[model samples]
Target: MKTILLKSGYSIPVMGLGTWLMNGRECFDSVLMALENGYRHIDTANAYENEDDIGQAIQTSGINRKELFLTSKVWYQKLRFKDVIDQCHSSLEKLRTDYLDLLLIHWPNKFIPMNETFKAFEKLVEEHLVRSIGVSNFTINHLEEALKSTVLPIAVNQVEFHPFLFQKELYQYCKEKQIVIIAYSPLARGKVFESDLLQKIGQNKDTGPGQVALAWLIKKGLVVIPKSSSEEHIIANLGALSITLSDQESSMIDNISENQRFINPSWSEFDA
Candidate 1:
């Protein structure tokens, strides 16, 4: 797997496994498969409610803890400074890991002061509970508010970043700030697989459309996590790390961006 260096000087695997809507034996099997297949990064959250399964997979994989880059997010309801620490600790306990590679605020909630939430993150970093901290679904304004509350650099912002919803403005801002952008639905929840352009590109590259989508993100230097429970799919997703997209092919996909989003929730004001 290729790696991207974080502000903390630690490297994150450019591709990872996403554990949303996965649980029980299914989640455990999928995670173990991913870890055994050279995947060093795993993205989960407190809201997912499957940290114990993830923890078991990691323990049984026989992979060194230092070799993995695990990430989890705190739910929006836990945005208060004290609650942030308590919730994070709960995640740590469930995952059976003393420290997290990265921690992120799941979403921006108006009820909680962003500054107060960030201060709690700073404390986590100071205490070494989390190596690096960041946010998800944050706009440029949200990021600015976070910056004002802490001296510790925000390492990355995980977001919905498929070709259809490129989020160009936010992408540019993150680049300028030297903050990595982690694409959660890099495959657009399988929507990208239905694209004609992606199919053509995949045929030419001797890969699947999913791989083509993932390759496009990697070519643009963005981090991606595409979820899958099938071992074959896991291997195919990892193969994307080796596929390189040409400028013409990349531009073809760029022209297909429609600013479409698939993961918007009632709690979020983000509409596309």
Candidate 2:
């Protein structure tokens, strides 16, 4: 797998497995398959309520912990400084790991003071519980607020990013700050499977439209995590690494950006 270098000098896999809605034996089996299929990165969260399953897979896979890049988020509800630290410790215990490759604040909520939350993150880094720290679903304004609290740069800001909901402004801002943008819902949550342009591109590449959508994001130099519980879909999603699109083909897909978003939770006000 290709890798991207973060400003922190850590390299992350260009593509990863996302465990958003996955659970039970389904998540365990899928994650094990992903590890066996050469995937080295996995994204999960506290709110997902599947960390125990994910930990079981890792423990059973027998893959060395050093080989995997694991990420988990602190849910918005735990935004208070003290609560953030306590929650992170709980996550580490559930994940069965002493250190996390990356830790992120799941969402920006008005109820929590950004500085207080960030201070907790800084402490985590200082104590060596987290290798890197960042934010998710943050706008430019939210990012600015986070920066004001600490000198440790934001390593990444994950958000809803697909051809239909391309975030050009936020993308540019992250680029200028050297912050990697981890794209969640990179396939538009299966909506891209029906796109005519993606279908045509898939046909030309002799792959599925989902692979085309993933290839498009890979070509744009963004990190993407597409989730699936099926072994067939996991294999097919990994095939995205072998395909590349031309500049014209990429431009054609870029034209399809209509600012469409698929993962809007009730608390979020930012429109991707």
Candidate 3:
């Protein structure tokens, strides 16, 4: 349960349970398991269509709201000012919370103006509906444009990050801007479990390869959220907190293939 300091002066858990591609009772059961375990952070989004299930999990777990850190996002299609405002309220309603610990723009909408979206974000913070605001899937240029305005503090940038998709420049830019880099898909979508190198490293540490990947990201000061529906994987993923990578091992992970990204969409502007 270590924490990372955000620019907005809030502390976020270094490890979180990512609820993506999970729905209904499965999502509820998974989240309940995570909370029952040592997890204090939970990540969901409007695009995921499972906020209600997540809310149900939270309500049933009986964990106090203040004791948990919940993060949800407004999807790309909902990037307009009006949509942003409405969606924030919708998300809050579905989450069964008066406010979100962190609210993020799910994706950069090339068609929408950044200032307009941020203005609504500012209003949310002003009204105490959101503690902090940030973006997801934002590259360096996207963040630069969003940072141009003095509307609000961009607290975090969650992205597809792992040894296979290591975004060095984006990571450094966020670091220099005091923006927390939240690593979604930190295990490379179960692909990390296939790598012999990761396995060897995990063997040295007496753990699994996925844990090795998580440990590497944690060692680099990045917050990681790896999604899992299985209780076994959920418990195993949390075990990553105990695995420490050597400087050399960290460097070894750094040199792994970086051309893979699991969550690419047709509308994504990754090359631009």
Candidate 4:
């Protein structure tokens, strides 16, 4: 697996297993299969509610904890100082780990002062509870606010990104600031297969559309976490690492016209 170095001096896998809707036995089996088959990064969150199953999978895999990069997020509603601490400890307990490689603010909550939330994040880092901290679903405005709120480096920004919704401006901003962008929904919730362009690229490359999508993001130096519970898909998705895109192929995907978004809550401030 390839990795990108973070501003915090830590590295994260370029592609990871995304466990969003997966749960129980399915989550365990999928995670176990991923770990056994070369995936070293596992992305989950409190909202996913499958940390315990992932914990079991990791424990059963017999892989050293230090060898894997585990990332979890604090929910948007839990940004209060005490709530942040309590939620992180809860996540650690559920994930069966003493520390997290990366912890993030799942979403930007306007009601929560960025300073207070980042203060709790800093406290976690100071106590060796979290290695690095970041945010998710944040716009450039939100990131500017986050940059103003903390002295610690904002190591990453996990967001919904794919061919259809290429956030070029935000991507460049984070790049210049040294904040890695983790592309969740890198497949656009299965819509990748519907794209004639991605399908054409995949056919030309002899790979699936999903792999093409992941490869495109990887080519742009972004980390991707595409979710799957099927062992076949999991193994196939891992093959994305081997894909090498030509400049014209990359350009075709970049010019995709749709500005579609798959995940958006009523509270989202994407325009802001």
Candidate 5:
């Protein structure tokens, strides 16, 4: 597993298993499968409602706590200072861990003050409850405000990133700030299988569209957490690490005409 050094001075696995929209026996099985396979990183969140399942999987795998990297997020509605602290503690209890490798704001809540949320984050870092802190689904404006609101380094910004919905400006902004970008929904929610270009690239590489999409993101120095419940697909997603895309191939993916964003919600302030 390739690792990237975070601004917080911790190394994070570039590839992680994303546990979203999964729960019960299915979540437990998928998480255990990922750990057994070559995965050392796991991503979950309060909203995902599967932290307990992931904790059970970790216990079953018998992997040392120090050997795995776990990430979780606080829901936007819980951005109050006390709520943030309580949420982190609750998440840790549910995950059966003393500390989280990385904690993030699941979404930017315009109604909540950024400094108040970050104050809780700073307290967590001080108390050794969280190793690093970050934000998810934040735009450039939101990031700028976050930067101003905290003294600690913003280690990462996880977002909906893939070839089709490539966020060039936000990517550049984070790079300038030395913030690692984690690509969630890196496969475009299975839309990769529909792209003729990705299919052709996969054929050339003797892999598949999913691998091609993941390889492109990896080649760009971003981390990816692609979710899957299928054992075969989970293992196949890891094969992307071995793929080496040529400049032309990468550029071809860059020139993709689609700019679709699939995960938008009514409360999202994407345009704001």
Candidate 6:
């Protein structure tokens, strides 16, 4: 598996298994399948409400904790100092791990003071509960505030990224700040099937539309978590690890006109 080194000096596999809406035995099996299929990174969150299932899967997988780069998030409402610490410990117990490779603030909560949340994170890192820290669904403005206020480096900003929602400006900002941009919904929740450009590229590359979308982002050095329940899909999604996008193909994808976001929760500060 390919890895991206965070500014915090921790390395994360570029491809991860995202568990959003995956529940019960399905979520359990998917995580095991990914790990058994050589996936080294896994992304989950407290908001997903499947951490217990994931915990069961990880414990049974028999993979050593050090071999996996596990990531989980504290929910937006839990950004308060004590809530952040409690959520992480809860996640640790549910995920059946002593520590997490990365812990993220699930979303930006303007009502909570950034200093309090980050101060908690700084303590988490100092105490070795989480090796690296970041935020998800954070806009450039939010990141700017975090970068300015946090004593520890903000290592990642995961968000909805795909051909349809090409966030060029945010991508550039993250690159300049040495922060990794993890692309969630890289397959756009099956929206890649409707993209003519992605389909054409897949055809030329002798692959599928989903693989084309993932390969396009991987080519740009972004991390991606495309969720799946089928072992077939899990293995197939990893095929993008070998697929390469050329300069022209990359630019063509960049030129895609649609900018629709598929996962816009009401509390999401996507436009901020």
Q: What is the TM-score of each candidate against the true structure?
A: 0.97, 0.97, 0.97, 0.97, 0.98, 0.97
Candidate 6: tens digits of C-alpha lDDT, residues 26-69? 99999999999999899999999999999899889899999999
The residue-by-residue lDDT of candidate 2 on 143-248, one tens digit each, is 8888787778789999999989889899899999998999999989899998999999989989988998899988888998999998899889999999989999
Error of 3 at 188 (Å): 0.6
- The best candidate in terms of lDDT: 5
At residue 135, give the lDDT of candidate 6.
92
Residue 86 shift from truth in candidate 5, angstroms: 0.8
User: Using lDDT as the measure, what is the rank order of every candidate, best first?
Assistant: 5, 4, 6, 3, 1, 2
Q: For candidate 5, which ten residues in a row score worst on lDDT? A: 263-272
lDDT of 5 by residue, 1-272 (tens): 89999999999999999999999999999999999998999999999999999999999999999999999999999999999999999999989999999999999988889999999999999999999999999999999999999999999999999999989999899999999999999999999989999999999879999999999999999999999999999999999999999999999999883778999987686235
| Residue 220 C-alpha lDDT in model 6 | 87
Q: RMSD, each candidate, Å? A: 1.5, 1.5, 1.2, 1.3, 1.0, 1.3
- Kindly list the per-residue Cα lDDT of model 3 for residues 174-195, writing each as its tens digit: 8899988999999999999998
- Model 2 error, position 104 (Å): 0.7
The most accurate candidate by TM-score is: 5
Compute the lDDT for candidate 4: 0.93
Q: Which regions of candidate 3 fall more than 4 Å away from where they truly are?
A: 269-272
Which regions of candidate 2 deviate over 4 angstroms? 269-272
How accurate locally, in lDDT, is each candidate? Answer: 0.90, 0.90, 0.91, 0.93, 0.95, 0.91
For model 1, name the residue pairs that clash.
Answer: none
